[model samples]
Target: MPDVACPESPVTPPPPDTHTRSLSRTLPISVLLFTVVPLVIAGLLTLTEGAQRLREEQELRARQTASLLAGRVTQLLASAQRLGQAMAVSPAVLAALQPPASADRAMDEPPSRPEVLGDPWLALIRSFPEVDRVELLDAQGRKVYTHPPRMQESPPVRHLTASQPPWYPREDLGSIEIGLRVTHDGADGWVVVGVSAQSLARALEPPAQDGGELWALLRDAQGRVLMLVRRIAGQPPEVQPLPVIEALAAPDARSRPVVARSALDDSAWSVEVQASLDAYRSLVLAELLRFGLTVLVISALSAGLAWHFARSLTRAIREVARAARAILRGHYLNAHVALQRDDELGLLAQSFNHMSRQLEQRERERDVFGRLVSPEVRDQLVQGELMLGGQEVEVTVLFSDIRGFTRLCEGLKPRDVVLTLNEYFTRMTHAVQRFGGYVNNYMGDAMVVVFGAPTPDPHRVERALHAAVAMRRELAAFNQERASYGAAPLEIGIGLASGTALAGQIGSPERCIYTVIGDTVNIAARLEGLAKHESGMQVFMNQATRDLLPPHLREALQPLGELALKGRGTRVPVWGLPEGAELPEPPAHLRRPEEEIL
Candidate 1:
């Protein structure tokens, strides 16, 4: 029979069959997309919406401020024009600008207008501290009767050629002016009030809290830049002049990519809240940056989850694979994977472990049965070819006993006796297995060994005799080892018998043993027992065993005369080891019952 061997390493399982399949293919892509995509998309959308809303809000505030300033300026200019009209019609102006006694004032009747009008116009200019350099001009454009008489020392202004009755008088002192035609008897007189351009600019200055990125340009009706304020990032916003013109003309030209502008109708001026396109672009870019960062964070979290999920899933798969490979190699001992979750993967692992346990148990049972009955018997049974019932087959049986065992036990402790028996049996059992025989059972101090039951053996007798010789030689070496321990040397007797015998599994259903039975078995036992009677011989066989042995082994046997065996119908020819000077003699004190009977 061929030697049976099994493999046992997990570091290398059988290489998996070549295939294109992999975890990437098996794992779902939709799970990754669903887990990550929505968060990124939602962040982008929210950012975009917020940016747009903020832009509109900022633009609205700019327009509102411009409109508010426009209304206030328009009211200021109109009120100043009304003040000029009131001053131009004053009776004090008629007396002060005309000669000390003029004909137009009519040397008649104490003049139609008052000569000293209590200087109410100077009081009006004084009341508005913000107004600087207000002037009262005569029809000739000269400072006439100026308040505090200080204006009379200034150089004369050129005469006005444009003042007329129901007059629209024109005054250009290089300042924003609101003048009413000053009429006495429907004649034109000059009453001009000047508003300082620097003062106007200062009055229109927006609060410093407005961010530095904002620039406000106040352009007059002629599209001249009166004031500009840049409150953020330290650069004045550049704006085209034509947009302001369009603003002044249409009072509705709202152009883009130029400035966030509101035209002031009352002043015929455009309050252009100047900004560059980059401002809105910057907002959009900021939103995009925020979106990119959010995407990175979401992607990282999603990747972590994916990795954890994949690791957990593959761990179970690898465990099952390893256990499966072990089973394939016929090494199913303790082949179970453990998982502690309540998910579906855990259930799958549980089922796999259950299957692994079943296989492991089956492997254990078969291994135990193989050791008990021999591999040959196990193979036959596993193949379903062997019948349970007994069958007669020619077989050779050997029985052995430790010689002088009862005497040896008397000299040693119980533990030493058992140890010696175990060592002796181990050596002898190896001898039988080497010669293709199975040890069926061990009696105290003896072993029953057999050849050719689960397997056929043409050389059964030779093999059995050889095993006996081998065992005796092995025991000699074992005795040498024992001697080193100051232990008494041990010896054994062997007996062989060859004949047809009944061989099969025998006993109750719950417990059974594959063994041989019949006269051949009993005779083998009787031969071993006879060793005690026949001068404590080392080996003995019956005539039947001797006839079957090969010539060499046959020549090695020496005959003893036919003897009556207990429970036998007739005398049987018995055999013993060849006579030689080297053959051992029995110890003197121990002998057989038969010798005493004789």
Candidate 2:
């Protein structure tokens, strides 16, 4: 087949934006659209969904409350029946039933064996405070016993029958009375107890703080609302049933009520809990108000943050450009950008600063060393073969962090805090140097020191321990001075670990740091954290570090047990030295002090 030349596809250009906007102006508007607009839309949707959810929750709550009330009512009835059954079988009631000696002998004469019934009735009333009255009637419907001896004639024995409903309204006495028919040893009568309607009404009413009304109805087997009880928020219970309960139960357009039914034995009785629709609406409104306010505050913050970010970004860029121009004009020392941020832009600013510093250092070297060394010698010194990677070397790492430094600084001015840290670090550095240790890094209120790094040391572990003890001694002296000035004393926790780690200058070509890294460094840091929380001990070390100690020194160390440190899978055994524990004096040649360091 002959090869045919094919035409290349034309590249399509994007549509031009005639009007370009500055980031400082575009950011706030874009943020408002992306953040505020979405938030507003979400708020509206949330309000709608929240209202529906709240309505459903209220209905569910009403159903649960109604069910609870029904359970309570059932319990009340069951208890009353049990009490009645027990009273009917009592000897006192049976004695009262026995032919009341000489029934016709004297109408007003004190009834024989009155004390028998009287004692039992009084005891029954005393045992159950809710029992308003304890009444015993005979088979002939004759009232035989009453808790409180009645002076006048007792009300006609109306509710003393087995055929009557178990529970009935005592209109004459203004109470709801429930009775149990008793037939024991051929003795038949009714054991009746009266319960104050108001008490029962109060039990059915919801708590006032709930901001809802409760309406409890007691209906007959025929579904007639026999007893209606109503309670509004912050109001006493209403035991009197209105002529029509439907009027009281009528709900508004927004009303949603939950109805629950419970039957007492065979008695068809139900309890209904109707939470106020208005209360549900109020709750939903309150929640929406909080949501709206939160959204408003967040939107405001987003806009402010966007504006600030745009302004800072542009300002930093401008500063860098200006500095670049200055550097081009041979003003390397003066060309620098100062920015305070932890983000990418901050890194850019830092890079610029590093570049300026390197340039200025090179310029100074040329000016000062130019006359002394040859051009070739100067070049070799300036651009030597740098160790760009790390090497595995056994070193003893010491990590120390100031305890309560944050709290201490809270009470001191920023300048005073800086001065205090400088003084503290100065003493600590002297202590480490006295034991032939190099202070590696200062991270916030923490310090990392290394022994046997960049220089071989056979006794690195011993030196690290000596340095830790010296640091403790220095801190005590420092604290005494602070106490004399009525200032708060500071405390520090030290952790030492000895192991093989990657040690060398590590970083980008622009900026490098000679530091150690590996599991040993991590263990030291973790131990440092643990020491701060440990009681009686200010210094801690891993088992590996402790293993290197001599028997005499090891005997003084307290076991810290196996600990599950973070970022490590296995539990590491640790040892600690009490604050009062001291090591033997160092060799005469190793007795260099702060004065010698100075």
Candidate 3:
């Protein structure tokens, strides 16, 4: 009947292909969230705070300017008042009141009219630059003396009036007069002090290049613009009339009626202090522009930083992702991430590299373990080995020793001895491995090799014997090469036995070795010792090993009579090929001892 084929098992599908792609996608997003977002938010907050500070600064500047202008106006008004009072108290007017001392005083009385008496007073008033024109009036409503009287004809004055009695109807003086009471011999009479409207207007004028305007207006008790300063001709028509009167009319006015005032004025003779809103606004606007520029610069810098941080974060994430992929692919040596910042991203990269190194170390350990154990045993040991364990098994053991190694070492320098020994061990180890034997351990120039414990071979005995012959042949060539360098020829003795041995790993768990321990191992070592001492040739085999060989192989072996061995009370028979027996020679450099003899 035709064989019925079993159905093949279903192959498991691989994991989703998007795993790495998903990680890459999330990296950029995470960088944006962690790096860029906070930077933008902080930049915006800083801009807002800067703008607020700028606004406050502008407001404070405006208030200070307004206050300074108000103070200037108050000073101007106080100066004007002091000049008026000094004019009112003139010594010239007082002298006019006293009678002439001589007879000529009668004739000079005509020259002594109030006009002559007021000359000095008028001159003094004109001497002051801020004063426009000064005039003195008698109580009869007629001008008695004047300085630049023609100035009174200008349009600024509504009307000029004479001084009158305090109780007289004030309207009769046309309400334009400055009524100051004169006291002579304790009797009071009204004296008029008239300032030219133009002169007063000029006094209120700021310097032509002052870039600001100042004005003063005189008003009656009823609040009229009796005199208006006309520094700039076209004053606002609406402002031509006195606003102080209207302000004073309001009962809620809090400023003292006769004190200096700002734009908030409420007195008949109020002074209005004004500074240009345009100039102030220009300053504020300039500051605002500056503030705006500052904010823009800061925002630009912040954006640049944000971009830099974002890119840095992105790069770090990419590096980490790349490293992780490489590690997953079993590439350990070059797995690393870009270290960009001293922040979390840098720390993450450091951790990823460290983890990769640890994984690499573990993988290296696994490879070393594979080399140490047989494949079957390695699998079980990797699963986890027990320290307190061993197994008894039938196996073939081979022992090799360099004959007269001590004498050779004594004759050579320490370095030369080590070099020769290493070379010999290297050749012997290669031969033993080729024959499927494990080199259990080395004792100076001696080696213990075993077969069929970690990995069992049915023809282990034959393999060990074959390896011993190969080793002899290889060592001969090694020595022939050394002889050219003035070095002695190398001779190695091999001993083989087959028996049950206790085998597994031996020594402390931390530093254990896999080897065999039994009578078979002891016999093999004893045979190798015999080869070094009483040998007819370089290799020896015990009777047990002899029994294991085929008849044709046995013919190749030459028997030596029974010899007493240490640790054993009985004699053991040993055998070897004769020194002159035909055996394949390696190259001239690798000739055996027998080949060298020929």
Candidate 4:
């Protein structure tokens, strides 16, 4: 079969994109530190700390106001009880309760006459104006006489035993009933006074600025709402049975209620002072207004200070940002921030300048290095895949020489010589890199390349062989272009050998380089020299490389009779690949290793 270029493998995969520019613009760091961060923090503190403090103050003031109102109600009830105690033992009250001469006389009273039953009790009630009505009960709990009787008949107060004289608050009558026992010479009786609810409200009100009108409730031990002061018009004449007055109000919309237990002897009643939350609401509003003002003042001052500090940083930072934008556009410029201060911003600017210089140096080195090695090898070295120390590994060595270059250069100008070699070497280098081969060194007019050093390739032999063939073919086209430029066409000889080799960083620490070295490399160099002398061919492959080629392309090689080389002890099988030729393979033979031309 005629010599043909190997089928093109998939193009070498590019390294992944690790970093990219953000598409959306964001707030600058200065703004974040100065205005935004402080605002957010202040708002959060105002909501949490300010609100909590206001709520706590409201709760405390409500409790204090409730206690004051409770004390007032207790005082009112205590005074009424004192009057009842005095009236209980009065001679008039005692005489009035005694068995009368006739039942008709006891009941006899002109309908038009409304005089006090007796002056001793009347005078006492007049003195204590809160005591609206008074009644003297017989030992059997029957009403004997009542001053200004509300009803023709009234039921006895329950929840009061003979052994205990109880203070009862009646919800149905809207009054407080105080019961006191009389024990003079064993003639026992009970004096009960019904103090009006209207008088109780007057006594329950606190100081004008303290809070709203205090509505007081007297409850028994059973948590019942027994009496409500000011139960007159538009008020519920009776308090319903419930655990607390809140049960009567809509949920979360009731007055703040403060309570105090009765100081009376029986201790059966309690006074609750219920008032609106308007006073506490006012207090909270005033506190919040002050807090808001403080926040505004502090925020303004903080922002100004923050900007002062941030301005120093932002100058350097903005320069860095602009420099980065230039780098993204392929202009590797430095920030060059000339901050004179010995602060972090100054250090940052210095670091940026140093990095920019490093990047500029690396760009030159990368271009020189990449021309010699595939990007895959570059990435492998960068990622530390190949350690600095040497390791034994199999690799393919390809050596190519510019044929007739020494003679061709003698007739050309010095500038032409360099331009020709540069163009020729560049084209050939590209061919090798396409097949994962790297140009390791340039020996005058000759080029030395290696396959699978930094990154080991299992198919190194075939790749080297393919790259050699590609280089041979690309040279023909390059020659045509050179002829058009009024320059002589170019030609080169390639020799490939593959075997176990020592491959790693090969030089001193100051200028270390990754390379491959062994007899395999030596043999490849010898093969190229032999191509110039004996057969003067375009490409040649040693036995080691020939064995690895695919069987179909192996037929493309033509066997030239074995020739003794300069140094080794054996004669080796050799094959030739002249460009555009159809060559038939020779029968297999295991020739002894000889100097293929040492």
C-alpha-based local distance difference test score of model 3: 0.57
Instruction: List per-prediction Cα lDDT, in the order shown.
Output: 0.63, 0.70, 0.57, 0.63
TM-score of each: 0.43, 0.36, 0.42, 0.46
List the candidate numbers ranked by TM-score, top first.
Answer: 4, 1, 3, 2
Candidate 3: deviation at residue 492, Å? 1.4
Model 4 TM-score is 0.46
- Number of colliding residue pairs in model 3: 5
Which 10 consecutive positions of candidate 1 have the poorest summed lDDT?
Answer: 165-174
**Per-residue lDDT of 387 in model 1:** 52
Highest lDDT scorer: 2
In candidate 2 the C-alpha lDDT for residue 80 amounts to 61
Q: Tens digit of lDDT per residue, candidate 3, span 1-598? A: 1111211223333323322333355445643354444545665576667655654554454344434444543354445446655655666654443443566743431221436544565566656554443444433323444456563453322233333321111232112224555555432223444433344443344333233233334443344434333233234312233445344333222221112233313323433322222223455556566656665666566665666656655666677778888988999987977576676566667677777777787777666665544344555555545233578988989988877778777856899887877788778877776666777777888888887777667778777777787787788789789889888786777788898999876666455655689999989888878765765675677888889877767777888879887899999887876665654332332222332111
Which residue pairs come into collision in candidate 1?
A: 212-231, 212-232, 213-232
Error of 4 at 434 (Å): 1.5
Q: Write the per-residue lDDT of candidate 1 for residues 66-149, one digit (tens) a residue.
A: 776666556656666666677677776655545434656433323222224475666776776444544555555655444344
Preferred candidate (lDDT higher): 2 or 3: 2
Model 3, position 385: C-alpha lDDT score: 50
Candidate 2 residues 39-116, lDDT tens each?
Answer: 877887878887778767766766676677667666766666667777788876765665445657424333423465
lDDT per residue for candidate 4 within 1-598, as digits (tens), equals: 0111211123333434432533123236544345555555766576667557755665565466556656766777889888877776667666555544677864554231234255655676888888877776655566666677654546643234576635666554446778887656445567777777667656544434344434556556665665554232233333333454545432124444333333323465555544455555666677567766766777676777776656565555567678767666656654344556575555655666666666666676666555445565555665556555689988889999877888888877899888888888778877777666766777788888888775678777767767787787788899888788687776677888888888776655444666677888887877776766756466777887888877876777777656555566777677777657643332222111222101
